[model samples]
Target: MSNVKLKNSTTELRDLDALHHLHPFTDHKSLRSGGARVIVKGDGPYVWDSEGHRILDGMAGLWTTNVGYGRSELADAARDQMLELPFYNTFFRTTHPPVVALSQKLAGITPAHINQVFYGSSGSESNDTAIRLIRHYWTLKGEPKRRIIISRKNAYHGSTIAAGSMGGMGHVHKHSYPVYEGFRHIMDPCWFDEGQDGESLEAFGLRAARALEDEILAVGPENVAAFAGEPVQGAGGVKIAPPSYWKEIQRIVDTYGILLLADEVITGFGRLGTWFASDYYGIKPNIITFAKAVTSGYLPLSGILVDDRIVAALMDHDDDFNHGYTFSGHPVACAVALKNIEIMERENLVARVADYGAPALAKLLARFEDHPLVGEVRSVGMMGAIELVADKRTRRRFDNPGRVGLICRDHFFREGFIMRAVFDTMVCAPPLIWGDGEFAEAERVIGRALDLTLADVAGEIAA
Candidate 1:
């Protein structure tokens, strides 16, 4: 009965939200007509809406909640820090204990020879910092003309102008303000879509990676500063590069003396069963931009891990650095992150991902690899994707891309699951705390959603 009243209140609240609230990446007109789903609470891999429906969160709140939802440890840490010292800026030569401890913890966990930390509230901010630091580093080294940063197409860095320019999504750039200059975009190593009809994966990967060399020379190596990329492209349909891709990328960047910046915002903090994708792939980038899972979505926190070589250059230059945020190292956020890491360590979550979670997810998702509706199935660590298609042999897309994806996305919610659809590819990156049971449930629900979508698109599919 209480759920009934709560549902009514939810309707009223949704009405209020439609009148005033503006959501990101949403079609406001359509949202106002359909109304918003009010999520009232969450507990251990599940969230309850106002109508009392328990939905399994497969995306883990935008791929951040590694420790899962409703962990009291994180809440307690935030509360304790709030009581002790809620607000204190890291600027003005004043640093708090939580920030200091977190810095040490981050440096210890990150790759060797990378000891400096710069804090921000989100990945966008950290990427912005990367842009400035890269340009400034070149300036300090007396080569201010080395301003161009190369990234891959279909990459997602962040939404800020600087970060967006660094990204390769032209549609996102068209809708937002004008993109800033000094950024180059190369083709991504998407073997499924970009590979030739008879080409091998390894051959395609090498060709795709060589595009970086082509771009650097086009921009002139003397003017190039860095090459930025997500270890695995998350928003770009959970695309996984071939094994040969990164090695070739590292080689080209090294040959040109350009900085390699790994954007680990999605693959960081054990998402890939390792501390960072840099380690998983055996590449040591000069800088790593991280956020999202750093605090397990418990609090907003993000930062960059700068190599000691860059730190040395900055120290010798003797400038203010002139970058930071009001909440640069907010004590409360650092406290939550510290606790989140502790929980992950105490539970051995990283090893579990390597030993159990990833393997189970791969085995489950592999069941759909040959399904008519699925063009491809890819999984790495806890993240995976099922690409929907109109014709499997040619990898042909739907007449209207993202239409079938929206249909499947709605079906996921109706069937009590939350999996994101990027265009026609359904992506999943569930919380690391999820086990075999949760994995089975996800497989069942997603399988059913695929069946329903297949039926809906039967006539459109080419037999």
Candidate 2:
């Protein structure tokens, strides 16, 4: 196509999007004014915008796409499945080969105790399923009153009503007014932000874990059904708890006999170098919610891996669970996920993250810790964060919480990379396929962005 035609197409697309597209978690007003960047294509770890900019996909397409982009094998899997069985509901006690095969694959890879799968089309749906499933399990055991599921503040589970209520972000909750009952939250283990002055990470971790116990006591243990959390708080600025955190959390949940729900939507399927973050953290959860990387975002698919104990409780009740989506166990999505996993295994992607990607990313991010505008640098597996601060010594934030972050994020885009900003914390989860070349480019692009952001926020730091 001619450059003139391409430019016209890009402009026309942007105009149409501004007119009709209502994006999730986006300010429509701002989006309309600024216009969204039109991503045209992706290959390996890079995406090309409509403007012909080749940028590193530092976020792995919202923490999915572990196998990177343009894998014809995944497309072929989808095409084959579509040709064979495009749409078949898993209702009426009916089953298909793709779903069954994927189910077995998931069960084999998940934690030992988790042997059953419940399907949905997104993380939000999966989490909503979890809420109902947890309550149902307790009710089956004759503890219907145990409905409250405790989570950490600022955590991002999903955007649906139930999932949003379960998450602790006040912004998300505001829109979900009269927020769903029986959901409570405690402080997240964001040591850099919430830790007491001079407190060690270990001590802060213990304190954070104890908060669950505190909330449980306040709510009455008998009334609490389970504790839910992401093993690594991905959307909450990649907040990784200290070493002591998950161990203590496990002990607390065990003590109270409440179920543990690990929301591994972002960290599952080798984002954290393990099949699930639960394994990485060494916590045995009763249920594990998974999505995103399961199919590398080739198609939307999400689900929960139920522990055998819960499955047994569910089985004891002879009636229907009365919960599921129309597209539950979608055959096409299942086929894509199966193929995605096959590629990951054949290429050893998970081990690649563990042995090289994680360490390399850590080193790359660490280089920015001494930047004038950076407060701290942290990473776990492929996930990473760089805290933008006005006062590094005092860990003080800019006046407007996300203002600096947005600025930095824009800088990253302009510098030929994509990085997400949670308030003043810039986070990235590059594809597992990223190697020395990607890391080298990231260092250059990210350093320039940071320097540019620092220049933009110099006045705030001075004040």
Candidate 3:
């Protein structure tokens, strides 16, 4: 660790935090009462808190940090780029070498049809760009009325007004000041929760996919602009789509001749054991929203991969697109992204996650299947989720959903592991760099936390 100013104690830092910091998605009253766990530093798949606890990060820093923490190579890349060209805009016909190279690199790895990228600073910004791009594309194609975009309930695209509107989460929408118009949502293809009694997983998935078709027809196919979805719903509890879902969605989009937008913010890079989850699912989307893992959370960089068709359409229009961010295609961020991809390629991190990390995690999590409190254990690539239920046979949830999940999440923290609780489902997306030993450690810690939570919840239920 570098020489830095030291605080008198963790309590001092917590006091400072409580005084000023308004954390995202946090309750001020709760934070003021309990204080916050201040993370001091990080290395590999672990982070040290202000109290000096070496906690294993099972959620991979909000589903980013796929390459893990404290990689000097990435830091060096940023430093070199900053020294050479710290900042430059991709607006007003200005161009930079780093952005140029990064664009080419992204094109090379993304789907064949996607050869163009529009950069932004975060996933929310990228989805906003996507909305404008899609709506403009339709306008250029002489379909100005085709503005409706369909999303799935519980899907999380981003938190911006435009992006959050694109997402289907009711909580975000409820609080969203002046929610944007022209968005419709259908049922999510989460078989574990929504599947009917005795309904096969494949059948349930197909039925869910049909919801998109139903919505499109209701809105009228000619009036719909595009359909947006995450390849795997990350914030929606790591909900993996059943085998038949993506294929049917692909058919629906193609049949309507409307655009298909894949929100790859969380599932992009190696999180899905492929360059992008669309490739894993064999679905060809017209636009792909990417962020988070592209730079492995080392730097803020997000973009939308526009299919060649859209690029061609824009070219034919010969009208100014007139949409961008101040830090679009930023040189230093682009340079760090290049270095991040290089490291992934050199280390074969994608292959490692596929052949080593994912299988190990799946095997370890599968043991919880027969546990009394566990209703289901599902995983894909390095991400997994364990759903907690009051009655396993009935898939009945606790009296108050998310209360038990919060309890389990607390246990994970106390036990030196970090897993996020989405309602009653405990989800994890550990770093791709984690190997057998890390997986084993995570399994052991998580198992112990679950046992403790089961007992705690049992007493609560009895009471």
How close is every model to the real structure, measured as TM-score? 0.98, 0.98, 0.98
lDDT of each: 0.92, 0.93, 0.91
State the number of backbone clashes in model 1: 0
Residue-by-residue lDDT tens digits, candidate 2, 1-463: 2454355777788887887789988998889988888888899999999889999999999999999999999999999999999999999999999999999999999888889999999999989999999999999999999999999998998999899999998999999977899899999998998899889999999999999999999989999999999999999899999999999999999999999999999999998898888999999999999999999999999999999999999788789999989999999999999999999999998899899999999999998888989899999999999999999899989997999999999999999999999999999999999989999999999889999998887888844
Q: How displaced is residue 136 in candidate 3, in Å?
A: 0.6
Could you tell me the lDDT of residue 142 within candidate 3? 95
Encode model 3's per-residue lDDT on 28-120: one tens digit a residue.
998899998888899999999977899999988989998999999999999999999999788888999999999999999999989999999
Error of 1 at 384 (Å): 0.6
Residue ranges of candidate 3 with Cα displaced over 4 Å: 1-5, 460-463
Q: List the residue pairs that clash in candidate 3.
A: none
What would you estimate as the lDDT of candidate 2?
0.93
> Residue 179 CA error for candidate 2 (Å)?
0.7
Model 2 poorest ten-residue lDDT run: 1-10
Instruction: Locate the minimum summed-lDDT window of 10 residues in model 1.
Output: 1-10
On the 0 to 100 scale, the lDDT of residue 23 in model 3 is 94
Decide which is better by lDDT, 2 or 3. Answer: 2
| Residue-pair clashes per candidate | 0, 0, 0
Distance from true location, Cα of 372 in model 2, Å: 0.6
